[model samples]
Target: MIDIKNLHKSYHMGKNSLHVLKGINFSVSEGEMVSIMGSSGSGKSTLLNILGILDEADEGTYTLDGTLIKNLNEKVAARYRNQFLGFIFQSFNLINYKSALDNVSMPLYYQGVKRNVRTEKAMHYLEKVGLADWASHLPNELSGGQKQRVAIARALASDPKLLLADEPTGALDTKTSYEVMELIQGINDEGKTILIVTHEDDIAHMTKRIVNLKDGLIIDDSKVTQVRAKAENYV
Candidate 1:
């Protein structure tokens, strides 16, 4: 339920222009899982930021579930992002001093959800991520996997139509990574659209389709099945 066409993005660096995305065009349907693979400066993350509405592109047309997002102001964009997008970052992005449940509930709270209703929904997602027992624990008290799971729970608390993840398992061990992926996979299986930007080859393979980027352009798109894990060309 996402559509993009001829996307171009650039930045100003000391009066010179640095292109981040030359032109990106892609589509992702509802209930499908997709991954983006690319080297550093290849525009994968930039593209993700654009799709996630964290940043605006210089020129492009993006329709997220039929909402054209070309010229929306920051206020509008922020409101839409909160309502429609769920973001999972590589750094977990959890508040260090807040309990896991509180962190997950914070988003909804900011959105004006009442305490009782949001807390119940937040706890439900935490239970789904196997973090029910650790709801009262702070980030420092939880392991990396636990922290990421908390982040996952937070992302799911909004019941967002789209889940946008950037290197979701990058900070965890292999076993933990697999565990988190399994959690994300479960969400995807339940009819949520998932778009993950990861450099891991196996992670890309686990998705139904992979989009490869190079030099700020989409170079390849293909359907593939899961294979053995190997080092990805993240360069």
Candidate 2:
């Protein structure tokens, strides 16, 4: 569902330029769950940003779900992002005052979906993430794991073609992280394409394949026996 070839990206720091991604090539197919693994300065974040269309690559070709992604105007990029990609961040990114249900409904609202329909869809996703009972709670009222579940529900509410998670379990405890991964695993089993950007080995192992990045390039790419996270063990 995603294709990238020889991607290159750099940032200028006064007189010097910091090369973030150099000659990087990556691809993820439909119905696949893949993890991009890397250390702090490994360029995983830069790659994710380019994949999410939040940032432009200085050089490279990216095609998502049959659409060529390059040099789009902000308006068009936003439209494509809403129509095709769902993002989950380490920080929940929920509006502090908004309840879980409201946060989940935000994307649909941006898509100009009707209020009633969006609300119904939001509730359905909240249920999918096992957060329907917590729907009325605000982010502050929920635990880290609950907040992430809400974030996951929000990402899924729109039914986007690709789900992009950036350090999804970064702020959670080990048990909570496993619980969250289990939820993610269940979603993948239902046949959605997912790409997770993570630095944790256990987190990466949860996915079907791992692509290791270093020095701004992919150093290793291989499939692994997926470690299924048992949410029940944590519960």
Task: Choose the strongest candidate by TM-score.
Answer: 2
Off by more than 4 A, model 1:
227-235
- Go through the candidates in order and give the C-alpha RMSD of each one to the true structure: 3.7, 1.1
TM-score against truth, every candidate: 0.94, 0.97
Candidate 1 lDDT: 0.89
What value does the lDDT take at residue 46 in candidate 1?
Answer: 82
TM-score of 1: 0.94
lDDT of 2 by residue, 121-180 (tens): 999999998889988999999999999999999999889999999999999988999999
Instruction: Output the worst ten-in-a-row residue range by lDDT, candidate 1.
Output: 226-235
What's the CA error at residue 116 for candidate 2, in Å? Answer: 0.6
Model 2 TM-score, all chains together? 0.97
